[model samples]
Target: MSLNANDRSIAAFTMAGHALVHWFETSIPIFLVVWLAEFDVGVALFGVVVALGYAPFGLGALPGGILADRYGTRPLVLACLGGMSLAFLVLAAASSIYAIAAGLILWGIAASVYHPAGLALISTGVEDRGTVFAWHGIAGNAGIALGPFVAATLLIFLEWSVVAAVLAVPGVLAVLYGLGAEFDPTAAVADDADAGPDEALSPAALFSDSRTLFASAFAVVFVLVTFEGLYYRGTLTYLPEILHGLPAIESLALPAGLEGIQPADYIYVGLLVVGMAGQYAGGKLTNRIAPARGLAAIFAVLAVLALAFVPVTASGVGLAPIVALCGLLGFFLFAIQPFYQNAVAVFTPPDARGLSYGYTYLAEFGFGSASIALGGFVLGEFSQTVFFAMIAAFAGIGGLFAGALLVGGDRFAGTAETLEANADD
Candidate 1:
C-alpha cells in the first residue's frame, strides 16, 4: 500500500528520532574504555556505574508509555530528544565520577521514552507497519553502529567531553523537526473509542482486563523477551573489552594516522553495521513468516553462536574467520528484535499497545540491565568462558520460549486479525 504524503512524513521523522535516540544510547559503551582510563576504576565498579545508567532505560518505559497514551506521542518524543540533548550537555561538563554517573542516569531516563512513543506512532499512524518498522529498525541499527564508530573516530582527535557535546547535535535537530511535525495518534485503530470512557484511561481497567495479555502467547513472548534482554545487554555491554582481549584482532595491520584506534572498536562497530541487514531481513520475515517461528529460528541461531564465540576466538584462528563469526553473531542477535516486536502487536489489544511495549521494553531493558553486573562479576572473578556460557544459557531459554509460542500461538492469532479487521473497517 502507498502511504500518503503525511504518513511518509511521519515515518521519516519517527525513523530519524529512532536513530537519534539509539545513537546516544549506544555511544555510551564506546565511551566506556575512555571513561575507564580517565577514572581509573576497576571493570566491576565501572560496570555498576554503567548499569545505573542503563537501568532507567528499562525502568522508565512503562511510565513513558502511559504518558504517551495520555498526552500524545509527538510531545513525548520531543521531550525525549530535548531531554537527551540536555543530558549530553551535562555529560560534556562532568568532572567527577559521580558527575558522569549522574549524566548517564539522566541520559538513561531521557532515552527511555523513545521506544514506546516511536513504536506507538508507527504502529498506530503508519499504514504498512511491517515495512515501516523495518526501516525504523534499520535506522536504529544505523545509530547502534554509527554511535560507536563516530565516538571512536572522534576520540582519536578530540576530547571525550567535546565528543559528548557534538553527539547532541542530532537530538537538537530532531527536536526542531518534531515541533512542527503533524501526526494522528488515532489513525490505526479505534480500540479506545470502542471502550467505555471510564475504562479507556483507567489503569485499573488495564490491569483487571489484562488476563488475555498474560495468557499463553503473550506470557511466552514476555519470557522470550526477558531472555533476549539478558543475552543482549550481557554480551553487548562489554563486547569491546571482549574483542580487545583477542590476539587475532590485536595483531591486524592498520592504515596511516589510524594507529591509535583499537581493533576492538572497529570490530564492535563492524558487527553492528552488519546487524543492519539482519534488522531489515527480520522485518521482511514478519510478512512472509509467523512471528513465533521466525523468533524460534533466529534465537536458536543466537544460542549456538553465543556458545561458539569464545571457542572460535580462543582457537587461535586468524582474524578473517573470527571477524566472520562476529558478523554472524551480530546478524542473529539483532534479527530477533523485529520478530518479537511484531509478536507483541499481534497478541495485544490496540488500546493497550503502549502498555504492551512498555512491559516489553521493561523486560528487554530492565531485567536485561541485571546482566551488566552479573557479566561483570563473572568476567572479573571467573573467566570469559563462563560469561559466554551464561549468555548462551539465556539464549537457550529464550529459544525454548519461542518454540512454545510457535506451538501455541494459534490460539491467540485471532486477536490480531480481529483488531486488524476492526481497523480496516
Candidate 2:
C-alpha cells in the first residue's frame, strides 16, 4: 500500500528519530574502548557508570509516555532531540569519569522519550502501520550500524571528544527540521470511538488503564521484551570490544598509517548492517505470521547464536567462518525487534498507545539495563565463554516466554479487532 502524505511525514519524522536514538546508542560502545584505555577503572565499575545513565533511560519511559499522552508526540520528540544534542555537548567537554557519567545520564534521560513518542506516533498517525514500521526498523538499523562506523572512522583522524562534538550537530539540524514538519498526530485514531479524550488521564484513571494493560497479553509481551533487552544490551554493549580481542579479528591487516583502524569495528558494523535486512524481513513477516510465533523462532535462534558466538570466534578455522557467524548473529539479533514491537500494538488499545510503548521500553531498556552491570561482572570474573553462556540464557528465557504466548494463542489478551485492523491488506 502506498503511504499518503501524512503517513510519509510521520514515517520520515520517526525514521529520523529512530536513527538518531540508535546512533547515540551504538556509538557509546565505541567510546567505551577509549574510556577503558584512558580511565583507571575496572570493567565492572565502568559498567555501573554506564548503567547509571541507561537506568534512567529506561526508567523514565513510563513518565515519558505519560507526557506524550498529555501533550503530543511532536513536542516530546522535539524535547528529546534538543536534550540529546545538549547532552552530547556535555560529553564532549567532560574531563572526568564522573563528568562522563553525568553526560551519559543526561543523554539517557533525553533519549528515553524517543521510542514511546515515535512509535506511538506511527501507531496512531500512519495508515500503513506495518510498512512504516519496516522502514522505521530499517532506519534504526542504519543508525545502529552507522553510529559505530562513523565514530570509529572519525576517531582515526580526530580525538574522541572532538568526534563526540561533531556527532551532536545532526541532532541540532534534525530539531530545526522537525519544527517545520507538518502532520495530524492522531489521524489514525481520529475515527476510533475508543481513542478517548485528548487529555491527561487522572492518576486513578492511569492506574486503571495500566492495570487493564497488564491484565492482558501486553503482560506477556512485557516479559518477552525484557529478555530481549537483556540479550541486546548484554551482547551489543561489549561486542566490538569482544571482537577486538579475537585472534581472527586481530590477525587482519590494515595499511601502515591506518593501523588505528580496527578491523573488528568494521566487522561489528557489518553485523549491524546485515541487521537492516533482518529488520525489514521481520517487519514484513509480522503481516504473514503471528508475531508471537515469529518471536518464538527468532528468540530460539538468538539462544543458539549466543551459545555459538564464543566457540565460533575462538575456533582457529579462519575469519570467514567467524564473520559468517557474526553475520547470522546480527541478523537474528535485530530481526526479533519488529515482531515484539508489532505485538505491543496488537495487544493494547489505541488510546493508551504511548503508555503501552512506554511500559514496553521500560521493560526492554529499564530492567534490561541491568544486564550491562551483569555482563560486565561476568566478563570480568569469568571467561568470554561464560559471558556468552549468560547471554544464551537470556535468549533462551525469552524464547520460553514467546512460546508461552504462542501456546496461549487467542486465549491471550488483545481484541481480535485490533489484529484485523493492523493486518496488512
Candidate 1 to truth, TM: 0.88
Screening candidate 1 with a backbone cut-off below 3 angstroms (N, C-alpha, C), the clashing residue pairs are: none
Error of 1 at 379 (Å): 3.4
Cα lDDT computed for each candidate against the true fold: 0.81, 0.85
- Per-residue lDDT for 1-425 in model 2, tens only? 78899999998888988899889987887898999888898998888898777778889898888778778788899999989889889989998899999999999999999998888888888877878888999999898878877998899899999999999998998999899999988888898654533474577667767776776778888998999999998888789788888887788887889897778867887988899888888877888888889999999899898888777766766788778988998888888988998888777777788888999999888888778889989989988899999999999899998888888846755543442233212
Compared with the true structure, model 2 gives a TM-score of 0.88
Q: How large is the C-alpha RMSD of every model relative to the true structure?
A: 3.8, 4.3
**Alpha-carbon runs more than 4 Å astray in model 1:** 1-6, 29-50, 95-99, 155-160, 190-200, 209-212, 255-258, 413-425
Q: List the residue pairs that clash in candidate 2.
A: none
Where does the lowest 10-residue lDDT sum fall in candidate 1? 191-200
- Score residue 137 of candidate 2 by CA lDDT: 94
